[model samples]
Target: MPIRQLPDTLINQIAAGEVVERPASVVKELVENALDAGATRVDIDLEEGGARLIRIRDDGAGIAAEELPLAVSRHATSKIASLDDLEGVATLGFRGEALPSIASVSRFALISRRNGAEHGAALEIDGGRLGEVAPKPHPQGTTVEVRDLFFNVPARRKFLKAERTELSHIEEWLRQLALARPDVELRVSHNGKASRRWKGEGDLLSDVRINETLGEEFARNALRVDHSGAGLRLHGWIAQPAYNRASADQQYLYVNGRAVRDRSIAHAVKQAYADVLFHGRQPAYVLFLELDPRRVDVNVHPAKHEVRFRDSRLIHDFVYRTLHDALAETRAGSAVGVADAQPAYDPAQAARPDYNWRVPTRPLGLQVEETRAGYAALYGAPRAELAYGAPAPAGEAYAPPAGLDGPAPHPALPHSDDASLPPLGYAIAQLHGIYVLAETADGLIVIDMHAAHERIGYEKLKHAHDGEGLRTQPLLVPAALAVSEREADVAEREAPTLAALGFDVTRSGPQSLTLRSVPALLAHGDVEALLRDVLADLREHGESRRVAAARDELLATMACHGAVRANRRLTLPEMNALLREMEATERSGQCNHGRPTWARFSLSEIDRWFLRGR
Candidate 1:
């Protein structure tokens, strides 16, 4: 066959194969167009899961009567023009193929009246054939109606699911949109009945949206994260480790106000929650990242659901460090339940914790100091220092005291000034020899003794072990490794980064490497395998955490071994010391395994539970 050009309608139908996959895909493209038009309110009316009809109305700056014909033309868009505009497109709908592509496979009509227009105009397209523009009375906005989706393409229509299933997909996509934009009012109607609505909350993002989208529990456990640095800014809410989900369904990332999925960013978040989250549990977050539009390429995906970062390493490091530090500030008692709302905290006036881990009145068996000493001997490293201002090893600084029985109380405090009581409050008694019962100002507190102690020990172990940075163990003979030429190039280029991570990597040939040393903590395990994994990570994310993750896992096991065991009897003073230490420890709300270590039961809730307030 001779080379020939396809008809205009054929070209659009082919593009529709990529842009219009289902009813949900059509909704995504049209709604994005609405948002780009500066629409504050968008009403969507769907019939039969949008297979039979989909009418989208938006109060935005509409197109002019003269431009109505070009609006549905292929390769026409108001979003971008020159190459520069394509490179740094800030709007959500930049590709001009959406309208034309969608119009080709369905019955489409577009009516609009620019905000200041004297009249309105409408145009209809049936099966890619255009109709003359006709005068139509419409408000100062745009209305797009699509009917019989995939009517011209029977093969594609057959692949669509049932009505309920298609509507569910639309709802899910709308949820993603709603999270990224709390200031936009969105309403949905199915079969002429209202299905859902998200009220506009302005640009100032608050927990009300989060509470409505996720749940009251998530908002209650959420930690506000607002940070900016190095030409980038990340601000949103991340649920505490205790409120993790079973899958990645709750993770939402928006780059420059456009929802997207980037594996590098996801990995960074997972790494940040590594130590605190339970095994196999996914953390919940609604994060929005903002950076110069030029630094990211959004043209990679047809749906624009992913982006390529110019400086992936820089972005990954920034995200990891930001979330890591924020989690570090998740001290015990910092989070508040919805019912226990209180005045903003003033850290300046906060009382410094005086954890009385000092010499007890008498000898007590099974002190934490003994556990640390035992582990220090087992690992042949220096005895560790305790956290929360606990005294150091004997004769080094302040030797931590462990009294299985004796009590060492604070000197004095004015009872009237309740601010002096630490956030975890003082332990009053033990329950079932496993739980610690404490009293707070507003209500009662229940704590898992072992879980709480395990977290405290883990933090101390990390500080003591990492105080001097990662230690490297030189191999007796440098090990040779084989790899792709590109991988080998990455290895050679990132030699300094490898060195900082306690690795000595040198390029030997076009596709080979020489490893002279490895992290001391992981030197025994196949160093070559570790090298391969690290190189692969560096190639993609521009950074690697395989070594650190291994090291932390080992530390976590040791911490678990050294933590106080359940069913162990505790003296009043011993329990109080543990509570105070919890108050000062980082990420103390959860154990090393990600389970919450403590829970607060407010007076109001307690009253309701017992029917005292009913």
Candidate 2:
């Protein structure tokens, strides 16, 4: 077979596959084009999930009649003058493929007039064939319409999800853009109804505007973050520690003025909040990072949503440190109450509706069925109860031990059920407020009063971890460390395991751990010192074969060193729970570090203390 050049239309369609993945991609391209044209106000309307129609009107410098023909031509752009300009490409739509690529698979129209033109001209293209530019009337700026997206490619069109999903993507895309340019007025309509509208005044502090677009509750809980270092400026708001979501969709990041989803920024934020939050929960934030444009490369991707920094390591460190400092300064006791409990929306300002499109709704129990089915579905088995055919067991559950050292069984000690002696090994004495003092047969036991209860819960988690693996939290910022000589050696050996625990530990120098990731549980822990400590410990102990075993040792070290201190006060149930967990635990004999966790006292000590005659 002889090789031949692919057709122009096919090439354009191929490019469209990269730039226009969905309705939102189309909106992103057009709106960006409008912004590049100096649009201060933009309007977007979608119909039939942007498959039937998408209209974007912008108030900016518009194309003249002569330029109308070239607007839909590939590589025809004013954003770049020569190939050298590619080195520091800044515009969001410089590829100049968006217009032509979009026109390749859909019916496209461009109507525009310069600021002082008598009348605007409109150019139409259907499936890449350009129609004659005809005289048309329009105000300053431009209006671009896309209809029947992927009409010529049935395969692409067929893959489109329900209308609502498509619309949601469009909404999300617009929201990120609006956040990037808070000064720009943006209005969005779906079908024929206005769903969102924002004021155009160049106000920078209109958190309310952002709230209107991104739920009001988010705005209310967001923490204002502002910092500058080494000629760089970072500004944005993050949700309070307690306010987080299950998905990372809530994280919005911007570089300069373009919305981006860079991992460095996400890693930094996670490191900042590592210890205080739990796994699978994401922090909500809208962060803006500003650096010299020359120091960053925005041309890495055609979509312009990811950038390459000149010194990524430095930038990562800066972001991590800044957020960490800000979080530290924030009062731990500060009320987490929402600034505005209820969102303020004008009922009269109704959102436009697309009556022609179906309102997307998933079937009830669809998720439940999928989750419950699991492997059953994979094996082509019908859904059924996991315990099908087994009658429910009938009985009163076993009663908890009535007292510490109760029934000659120590409830909190690991070896209590050794078939030799009770775990707690003592009888409960008089209960005083929150403390539980007990007498054992051998040693006099004095329990933590509180940890007595927490031990049980911690044991369950630890056992689960031993069977599976330790639970990890991604840090909000990477910790920094100038590792000690010994520490450096051990850190190098266990670096990978530490990373799995959610610490972004990178060896900057032979003796340095330029920490980028920290354990999620130590979100706010001092990164530098922690690295030093971990490494030092590893250096003290020889290398172990099993990484999992090493991780357990590290975890034990962390738990012993990080859990609530012994002297701290506790409630009755908390103390009791700790005791119960200790009883159920295999390591209840000692704390994570092999330190005796508790002391036992015998009932005979009471008579001796009371001075009663024997």
Candidate 3:
């Protein structure tokens, strides 16, 4: 307990507590070391979930005979030579504590022969007891064998789970590593039988590797994202909203080739999917962020699983904007049609030379104006006519249509070309007073009328609000609220940001602030609670959107109430008009609440339902 130096073995045993938690942790360190050594192929052999034995052979630049002892010495490594090297470490394993700590808890042997060496050397260490190096025959590579892991530390060994559970942990970590380094071939064997193999090819991860690691469903639903600007680059695949998961298990994020879990990055991704994903749903993606190595500090954690960025706000905004823009293109009636965007494979058509796998494009000049004009004449004013009948006052239901179909029938709208049919097509009939059945060129589309109209109205409101800017209403008497000193500092510092959001706040006392005006859209909101939340957000995320969010929420509520209600009948022209507006709107694929607005069933799929082709 006094100021005394601990024995070398005791020091290593203590370090093992941090570096060697389980067989999987040992595997992680060894594999990372192998990768740093420029290994192209790594073969791992495990027994009893790597508790009894773990042998790793890598075709990398091996150690020299003279350096065999130092390789397992504490705080000795060839990865870094100076303080500058530690600042921006490009290698995966540079701590220099892994080998020594691992040796202290197990029976460890390291065998190596550098390229062109006529002979090889081997060293063995049993529970921190080092032995002299001895000559041994080995190929031009390195092989590390560990036996009876944690044999010297019974307490650590007791914490390890069962064989199957430990093996699963190892496999999961390997899968994550495989995603980061698709250029390295990895093979794993358990109990003398091979279990997993990942073939290495190409400078970047291929679709085949993604499919194998994540699954075919993910690969099929994923969209390629490549964006670069402002001294940063992000590229990877993100699944569409329809392919969401129940948990964050599939969200893999890497910062400069190192897998990390940063709250700012995660928050940014969640915000990007805020408008599209349903509540409680998690997005699945494999995103890689690349920036100058000096800009991020990887030394924040021993496991290298967390990173601190010099400009976290910049990084957060970049990630949010990139994914938000990509998802925006999936809106209804957008250039990317749902039917064409979701590709279908045909085995019979594989042999056809002229088969087109590309997404089809509709003609630009389709007389959309003429269609709108025709609908306006029949439906009267847009706000006055509901899908079922003329709009009644608040809380009163409009009379249902005399029949499912309208009283007056109009011919199908004209088109410039056969391919000029709008992506949503033309409405044929109403189903259950909620869904709109439409006929398309190659499929049938069923749309939720209420959901579709809600999305359309929401987008329109947003556009109008943005174009006109936030409208500020002066309060008759300024509202005053007390806050913490830190909150007051933020309020004073971000006065300009508050003004832009249609809020005018002035410091009153040491820890008090006065609000003179509020945004017209959020006039009825809880000003004190909203301001406090905004201050909290600014304190945590370096940015706050509470004002804008409150405004948007109000707009969403208005759109929901104004949307066509259930049990309302939609005539062909009214339905068609809604479809056109949806096509022209943003984020129309889903309503304000993130439920899908429309779905499509291809003709081939319909044929399969009835076995027509068979």
Taking all chains together, each candidate's TM-score versus the true structure is 0.88, 0.60, 0.86
Q: Compose the digit string of candidate 1's lDDT tens values, residues 317-415.
A: 999999999898666777453333444333322224332432344233334343334334332234223322244557654333654333344232223
Winner on lDDT (2 vs 3)? 3
lDDT winner: 1
User: Which candidate number maximizes TM-score?
Assistant: 1
How many backbone overlaps does candidate 3 show?
0
Residue range 1-614, candidate 2, lDDT tens digits: 89999998899899898888988999999999999889989999889879899999999899989998787888889998876687666777677889999999899999999988999999999998889999998999999999999999999999999999999999888888877777789998888998888777645455755576667777766667788989889887777655678888888888878888777667667766653344567778888888887788888887777888887756776887787665543221122223543222121111111111212232222222322232132212331233112222465323333452422222332222122232343334424444455433334556653333333334445566667644455445544567656566666767775666555666667767666555444445454555555554344322221333344444555454445554555433233333333443433433332233455444456668878786
lDDT of 3: 0.81
Please say which candidate is ahead in lDDT: 1 or 3. Answer: 1
Worst 10 residues of 1 by lDDT: 379-388
Better of 2 and 3 by TM-score: 3
List the candidate numbers ranked by lDDT, top first. 1, 3, 2
Candidate 1 residue-wise lDDT at 397: 48
After superposition, candidate 3 runs with Cα above 4 Å error: 333-370, 373-422, 508-510, 612-614
